[model samples]
Target chain A: MSKPVIAIDMGGTKIKIGIVQGNTVLSSDSIDADSGSGLRKRLPFIQKAVEDLLDREGISLAEITGLGMASPGIIDSIQKKILSIDKKFGDAPGIHLEEWCLQTFNLPFSIENDARSALWGEWKYGKAKNFDSAVIMTLGTGIGSAAIMDRQLLRGKHFTAGILGGHSVINYKGIHCNCGNKGCVETEASTWNLTSIARSDKNFAESPLAHAPAIDYELIFNLAQEGDAAALHIREQSVQVWSACAINLIHAYDPEILVLTGGIMASSSQIVPYIRKHIETHAWTPWGKISIEEGEFPDTAALLGIAHLVGN
Target chain B: MSKPVIAIDMGGTKIKIGIVQGNTVLSSDSIDADSGSGLRKRLPFIQKAVEDLLDREGISLAEITGLGMASPGIIDSIQKKILSIDKKFGDAPGIHLEEWCLQTFNLPFSIENDARSALWGEWKYGKAKNFDSAVIMTLGTGIGSAAIMDRQLLRGKHFTAGILGGHSVINYKGIHCNCGNKGCVETEASTWNLTSIARSDKNFAESPLAHAPAIDYELIFNLAQEGDAAALHIREQSVQVWSACAINLIHAYDPEILVLTGGIMASSSQIVPYIRKHIETHAWTPWGKISIEEGEFPDTAALLGIAHLVGN
Candidate 1:
């Protein structure tokens, strides 16, 4: 029998570590991610997190066959290196993660983009199974997306293919995105931009949401349920943005299944249906309907995916 | 040496027929495509057009290996059938082009979406020859697009995959498209919508363009050259829309080569540079720059592409 694997999902807010067995995470843990000082500063903390998780699971480094790490930004999986990161893990390109893994665990190592890793998990073991083509759309702080088109992950010549889902323009004349484009779905709607979107509404000053410490989808959804005009307006607008994005993605990649992930899925029951209605009304799918699924393990998809990444 | 191929590019306004040898169309001719009735009514004319082209080239039916048709609709290239078409050929789904070919010329037949056919030509014999991934953007009456990713054409499960490039939303709140979506790049900038875009400009009534019989990109570009206010306003706005679309597509398909085609390329020398500048400034390609090339055989790319499609 194959030994267990160690998986790491490196994100902007958290570094999640897991011991994955088959398709399941046997044990998992996470640590606060602080990139203000760069990735090098967090190495010791990451090492401790993994060790503690292994200890709690009663597993040892010698029993692990390989380690997989999912990191943010552009990744050259074939070269086993991080290419570039705009905001998080500024030191990623300089850090030799594969070498670090070899020394730390003395095991084979592989690294992938966090979203792509999550897609790998879904495609291989979760919702995307049996489907030849699938797309993973992760909605949270910013939109994270990856596609498996024609039964292959869309890795373009630059290795940035299928990872720029958040940056695709959906409203060309709208707000300029941090990535340099304008009217991107991420700019129009997303947790990080939700506050900005809320503040931009004409009713913000007169609405109760203005008194809140910070704005997020949860608060907006909660307030909208109580018939807050500002909240309702923002919620419906975000849903349209997301639906437009979904249709745009459908036209771009033509996936059989679109797996929704990230923090926004917490209110999947309330919001997913609106997205579905919009897609049904506007998406030009002549052949049949696409299956939209919520990710089975939103928080740990990248971890479980990294296991497949290293294992395969 | 392989036998020559008969190529047909089925457009809304014209049915272009060609006798193609290698990558070149040795002889070509076109007939009016009157779809006011149905595709069945045009079959005999299509037959005559092919025969006339073969006669002009002094080629016999036995000298041709097969017939390839590039139709404007959803195509099942694998099954050699048209799946659906909203406009040009309403009876495409019921017609048997393969049977027609076998009966008329005893030749094998294959069909593909016109955009995909053009992409096949570019990828196989023109600008995209050396690239593993490529995308074609044909900006004319409508925005026609197709993609080749990971060394294969993106023919998704239903075969409407990469051909819907123009329909990808670039502005969520912009013009609604005839195909049921809003803010599509096609709706914002293609020739079919140029009139609406021009008329919406406040200066349209004062500008000389109001006296013109038709409002098209040619008129707009020509008027802009002469410093017409409405023309200039619409021209700049269209340019921005196209630029946004370029960046959006760059993110969507991640192609190494983006081959521009269709009627808009008539002003390629004047307009392509502006698009290049926008992509350079806004496209989030961290790996490297994408090569934007005008299609080498814009008028006959689909013809040559059909040759490759049928031959292969």
Candidate 2:
């Protein structure tokens, strides 16, 4: 059997740590992040969670091949370090993650951006296996994307190439993005901006969405199904924004297949067909049509991707 | 001295054939293209033009290392054939260009999309020579773009990856493009659509632009310089479209430098500063700022690029 590897996925609100063997998670644990204090303050808790997982699984540190970490922001995978943390973990770039791994477990370590890690996971062990070129767009709080071309991950000059699809301007003059760009796809149709977009509709007050306790895609989609006019408008607009984003990504990275993942994929039945039909009708792919599909692993994808990266 | 290579650049209105040594054009000839006749029908004329150039320069076919051709379409460089021709030379894909080279000149041949060829030329010999990662945006009748990542031309699953930056949707709800996508940067701000965009302005009827001999950037820029209200509005809108396109390209392909080419760079004095300011303020490049510059070669870029490809 292949040796087990320690995998960590650092997300905005939670951190998941696990002992992974091939595609199986032998043991795992999750902890809420200290959002106020940032990633640096939460390091000890993460380490303890990993230790507890191993102890519960009766696994020795010596049995682990290596440690793999997936984090939000730009990651210099070649150097095994986080290059930037954006706003999620402000102190992450200052942390010597590889050195910490060497000191703690005496194991080799690898790190990558969470989005790219998910892509690697999908490409190596999930829906995108056997495809030489593929792109994965995670439509959640923001649209996170990653691309693999010619069987190699596209890490651009600054390690920001495939991860910025959300920030790609879909409506160039429409709205302002927190990233400082105007009309980014994220600004137009992400969970972070969904409420504002819903509220902006003049008919929002007349729809069931305005009466909902909390506004989200689930509520909007539910209301739209119930024949709410404003809900339907917002749903259609969101689909168009997402479809435009899909087509933009298709044009940007000429991939053979596009895997749609993220919190929003719970409605993949509606989202997948919309984007597929848009690409089929609009994309100028003379070679052939691109395959659009749902992602295989959702919650554990980055963890699995970390396992693949470390194993490789 | 190295043996010369024959380079051919097939444009919409003209065909240029040249014998090249390194960065220098040893000898060259240009002939007007019969736009009504397809590329297959014009094969004899192209061959005769090449033969005339070789004879006039007193060079034998045996002295040439190989033949390299650049055409305005989706070129399958590996197979040395055009994949799609858009409207120009609509029957180009039916021609077996490599077979024709073998039958006529008995030489190895390679073909590339004109945009990619220009990028290679710039990367190998022009402003982007030392940069392993760069993007070139050609702003002409339409916005054409190509990218070089890690020193390799980024040809995606299909041969369309780095060459479709122009078609990337910038305004998801704005206008329908001929390519079938809505609100592409090309549709928003290219020469082909400039008149319609200008006419859509309410003040256009009262502006000096309403009486121009032809509606092109040259006329609009001139009027904008003279403080024409409608011309100035169009100029600002075009710049925004172009700047948005620049940001989208930067986000899509993380390059160290962006080289702006094509006919519109004639107004680089204004275009360069606007895009530079936009990128400096908006692009999330943690490594550093990306340098924006005008293309070194305008008219002869693809010809020079073909020379580099065949020589290498």
After superposition on all CA atoms, what RMSD does each candidate show versus the true structure? 1.6, 2.0
**Quick one: best TM-score, which candidate?**
1
Q: Count the backbone clashes (under 3 Å) in each candidate.
A: 1, 0
**What's the lDDT for residue B2 in model 2?**
64
Task: Give the per-residue Cα lDDT of candidate 1 at B39.
Answer: 90
Residues B1-312, model 2: lDDT tens digits: 668999998876678888988887888888876756788888888899999989999999999999999887677888778997667788888888889999999999989988888888888789899998999998887788899998899888779988888899888888988777778998999887888998998889998778877799988888899998998988898999899899988999999999999888898887899999999998878899898988888877888898888877
- B1-312, model 1: which lDDT tens digit per residue? 457999999887788989888888888888988876889999999899888888887888978899999988789887888887866678878988789889988999989999999988988788889898888888888888888887888787788778887888887877788888888888888887778888889998999888889888888898899998888888888888878777877888778888889987898876799888888888988778889889988899899888988888
Model 1 TM-score?
A: 0.97
* Candidate 1 colliding pairs: A171-B171
Q: Give the lowest summed-lDDT range of ten residues in model 2 chain B.
A: B30-39
- What would the per-residue lDDT of candidate 2 be over residues A1-312, giving only the tens digit for each residue? 678999998876678898888887788889996655787788788889988998899989888999999987889999888887656678888989898888888999999988898998888888899998999998887778999998989889889999999888888778888787888888899887888999999889898777788788888888888898888888898898888888888888999999899888887887888888988999989999898988899888889888888988
Native-contact recovery for every candidate?
A: 0.81, 0.86
Candidate 2: regions farther than 4 A off: A34-36, A103-106, A211-213, B34-36
Q: Best-fitting candidate, measured by DockQ?
A: 2
